[model samples]
Target: MTELEQDEYTSACEHALTNSMNEIKQRYLKLNTIFLVTLNAATSGKKLMALLLRRLQKIDSEFLSGLSGLVMF
Candidate 1:
């Protein structure tokens, strides 16, 4: 490709990446807020806290794996 075309392609790719990162950040924040609320509500129950911890660990591993796959791509 020509220099101008290459630059344009790079710019587009960068913009798309930026948008995707922003979306991921927003989603992570929302999920974090929900988790915090749930944790607070479950503070009185040991069983509930353990369950939440397990679920969160599972979700964190899955999220990390998914991110790794994306990075590989």
Candidate 2:
């Protein structure tokens, strides 16, 4: 391959690698957050569990509403 073609291939590979790394990082963070929340609720008792449930319900409702709005478009 010509030098320009080699350079373009290298650039594309780098971009894909960067995107993969970012996705991995985001997944790790989401898992870590869930783990920490579970641990906290386990140690803190029913109050924390209830609070988390309420927050989760609110988030779920909001997410559903957002999806409905998107579907309307």
Candidate 3:
């Protein structure tokens, strides 16, 4: 692809990643409230959300790094 297409791809990728992170953050906050209210009942869900958040973070980092490499060309 041309430089313009690459730039557009990078922007779109970053925007999508940001949206994903924001959604996850909102869900995590909601889960936190539920965990506080229900204690034991929400423990598993909270843990799963935490795990998912961490994995998404890792993926985000890897994705940004890969995109940066691409931009260097």
Candidate 4:
């Protein structure tokens, strides 16, 4: 392939790799928050977690910051 074509291909690959890594990072953060919630639930026991979860539902900040990282593109 010509130099121009090779450069274009390299740029495209770089863009794709960057986008893929960003997506993976976002997903990893989401899963980690999920795991934390699950662990909190398990340790505190489901019933208390259920009650607390309901209470926490109204308070967005507790979990919303973590969620924002996953949502903000």
Best by lDDT: 1
Candidate 3, pairs of clashing residues: none
lDDT by candidate, in order shown: 0.72, 0.67, 0.64, 0.66
lDDT of 3 by residue, 1-73 (tens): 9999999999999997777666656656655654455554345687766766665566556656655555563
lDDT of 2 by residue, 1-73 (tens): 9999999999997896676666556655655565568668977898887777666666556555645554553
TM-score of 4: 0.59
- lDDT for residue 25 in candidate 2, whole number 0-100: 60
Q: Which stretches of candidate 4 lie over 4 Å from their true place?
A: 47-73
lDDT of 3: 0.64
Better of 1 and 4 by lDDT: 1
RMSD of candidate 3 to true structure, Å: 9.0
lDDT of 2 at 33: 69
Task: Please list the residue runs of candidate 1 whose C-alpha ends up more than 4 Å from where it truly belongs after superposition.
Answer: 44-73
The superposed Cα distance between candidate 3 and the true structure at residue 57, in angstroms, equals 22
Q: Between which residue pairs do clashes occur in model 1?
A: none
Question: Arrange candidates by lDDT, highest first: which order?
Answer: 1, 2, 4, 3
Clashes counted in candidate 3 amount to: 0
| Weakest 10 consecutive residues of candidate 3 by summed lDDT | 34-43
Superposed on all Cα atoms, the candidates' RMSDs to the truth, in angstroms, are: 2.8, 8.0, 9.0, 7.3
